[model samples]
Target chain A: MTRLTFPPALHAEWIKIRTLRPQIGALAAVPLATVAFSALAGLGAGDDDILFSAFFGVNFGQIAAIAFGTTAVSAEFHTGALRLSLAAVPRRGSWFAAKLTAIGLPVLAVGLVTGLTALAAGAMTVGPQARDATPAEWVRGTAGCAVYLTLMALLAAGLTTVLRSGVGALSILVPFLLLVSFVLGDVNGNAADFLPDRAGQVVLHSSWDGTLGPWTGLAVSALWTAAAVAAGLWRVRVRDA
Target chain B: MTSIDVHDLTKEYGPRRAVDRITFRVPPGRVTGFLGPNGAGKSTTLRLLLGLDRPTSGTATLAGRPYVSLARPLRHVGALLDAQAAHSSRTGRDHLLVLAASNRIPVRRVDEVLEETGLTPAARRRVRTYSLGMRQRLGIAAALLGDPGVVLLDEPANGLDPEGIVWIRGLLRRLAAEGRTVLVSSHLMNETASFADHLVVLGRGRVLADTALRDFIDARVHPGVRIRTTDPAALENALTRQGHDAVRHPDGHWTVRHARVDDIGPLVSAAGVPLLELSAEEGTLEQAYLALTAVDAEFAARQHEEVRP
Candidate 1:
């Protein structure tokens, strides 16, 4: 008999995500929504932090990221998918880790590509103001864009595992990301910066007035994702599949 | 050693217990039919065996290791708990491919299983478009993908056509003949009688019977002598004088309960009775199983003792 190991389980999860049509759409929508909206934000031209403006399409793009994360795990909760999955690999820890890894890698790759394309699209619309953006800022923004999107996707997947429903995870994350996060942005001080989305978006700005810096902000978001993932792992360990 | 051993395994969902302290052993080279009603916890027990559901107390081990602890569980134990467990949007081939990759099974094996299950033509179609029988075939293919030592299937014949049913019976028998431990769960005793060699019956989360298929029927049901003769009065007199209580039917045949044909034939001959037919009237598997698990044990008991001389 062959041994069930982490590497093969991860490969299996990757194939699962790659093959599903809705999951593919969710991944593709990340770049499409990001570049399209980043170009629009560049044309509007009122925001002082041109860096955030260029990456602003992430507001819409992150929704797709969360969808990808949610669907990847939520698919398991469908009729007998998780049972089949666990039957193939009985180690819940390895299977959950593999699932998250599969979610993180693809979004990170797509997020990086989306970052560069959105920056160029934003520069075309913002005119000479885009030239003021330095190489250091571009590198940081792009890296942060990729990492931040990946973290958010991981966060959604973690939540999906906890909720065990794609629609359930989306119902909470998507609306909260769009309405609650935006509304909270207008109402509070640095305390609002601690919210997962706001905290992670800190890196995209060329300058900031918030309490958190670039890496520290993403760290806060990572902590939230970690907590969600821990709870999800616990659920997988204890609950009936 | 047995391939699968479940001991004192219990699962309680709030106040109600789904599986209550049940124990049984599944030996290799035989098909053990897991027979139970819908709410009798057959599926729950299978889930516990596969480590898909945590047990309240006790243990279920495969070859002396908990399923989760096995190095490659699918390679050791293949299970089909639910045919609908596969996602509807994924193609049938991809579904098997994902499982094959998970256990490190080669990709070519996926095609082989598809062809084995007669699903090669529909392998590319999404599961949503497939019929129930196709889904069952897909599920069976996934179970056999690893070609594991132990096979567990639940209600495998639910949506199968007559040909599919025949195919499954042969497949199950062959798996047992190959010395693999096969556990097939169903509520139909007659269906299992065709393929299963041993039986593990459950009713209300408790083991009602576990033994060889023939013994299960033999122990619960008394297959008494069925005698036919031209002179019914002489045969009845001979049977009564031998201390046998024979029931005379309206059709002119006599059914002697708790009586053996070997002992009755000589008695009738000495009594100058000419026999037309002499045989044992064995009870059907369905009749035997129903008697054991019948809703009222008291009634079943009455039926059992109803054969008293």
Candidate 2:
């Protein structure tokens, strides 16, 4: 006689994300791309910050994370999944919250694993420079890397919900992460650091020149995620499924 | 006690009003056919009832409550809006599982529904690889998973094979027999006539007819005298001379509209035509549907955009 709650909805979303082969591959790429790219970046490393070099693979992983988030939301838009999902749950807000949580948790877990692997690989490549980083610094970078990637994935999920197209979200996000963040940084100066990718990535840098500190920078990225998520929720409420 | 009640429901998409101000009730222990043509707003009405789309004006509710207000919606209403609504990459079993999980339904019910819908063999296959018929079965499986009191299915037989069609016919019948309120929408006239006793006929986003199927047919169509004679031309001439409109079939049968057996029996004797077959034919549902829609078309033509229902 109980009402449907958040837990079952979350469980359902979890099952949906895992059952699909492509979604599983998208998630796997989060860690694979991060660790792999970090290893590749290590070979070219001569004299770089010990912590940031270990997390460089995170740059590549962000694209895959965006893909995972975008695909998770976009798949529901196609072929009438939204109709079916709404029919089953009916409460749009509760279902959406569950969907975002389902998207964030796995990416965060995989991102942490990727961070640890990247650090080990960096330690091998940098040789003696790895000892220069304090245990506290290593812990901060690994944890920050995971949280940043999870936030980016959630940001992408929120945008995908609004756009209702994975390609639409990825096309804007992927290119911005690859180039626009840097371009805006040079052109717009300190203001450009507020971009989601740049603001979130600040935690990885051993020394940052931007006005925002590590926590404040992540908070700026979170503000962008919150705005996208709010818009997406409004769209789902006002528009017909 | 549970019934689907729609009150003055209307849906407008820009300038086009897909579902006009229409209202009807689908009560328990009966199969109500929501019959309409392609653009008759059958799908649109069902979407609004299921809370997939908001109505421009009016209310659609189950047991006097809106669909979205139901805490456990799947426990009260099972719906199949589109068979292709499930993601292409998920296995058929997983799609039903997602629905069951969302509703707090037991996992074993998923297996039972799959078995009932004849999708057990293909349950593990991804939806992309399944045929349209298989997808339909999978959709039915999802609908039956919750074992809800009311069932709403739109175009449930769209892609079904003959055997699948027969299977669904029995399934709907059995569901109604169990005293569940079942509403099935379809544009196929004869297919609906076979299973439904109560009918809600929609034409141009309006309720053209809402009554027992027999009453709808009897009201819209007139009975005709079916006559077969050795000399078909002579029989036709006598009926025409008497000012009766007689339609002739390729099989040499003559159907005299608005005429009785007594009207034709005396004439056939006077015409000296050797009669092969003579009987009063009840007006068919097909004839009634055509007559009803044809009238609707004429009104649409006369009024253009101003025609209501």
Candidate 1, residue A155: lDDT: 90
TM per candidate comes to 0.92, 0.92
* Share of native interface contacts recovered by each model: 0.82, 0.84
RMSD of each: 4.2, 3.2
Structure candidate 1, residue pairs in collision = A80-B85
Report the number of the highest-DockQ candidate. 2
lDDT of 1: 0.89
Kindly report which residue stretches of model 1 are placed more than 4 angstroms away from their true locations once superposed: A1-4, A185-188, B225-244, B250-254, B259-280, B295-309
Instruction: Provide the lDDT at B236 for model 2.
Output: 76
Instruction: Compose the digit string of candidate 2's lDDT tens values, residues A138-229.
Output: 87788888889999999999999898888899988998899886566434346788988888887887777778777888999999999999
Q: Model 2: runs farther than 4 Å from truth?
A: A1-4, A182-189, B230-252, B256-275, B305-309
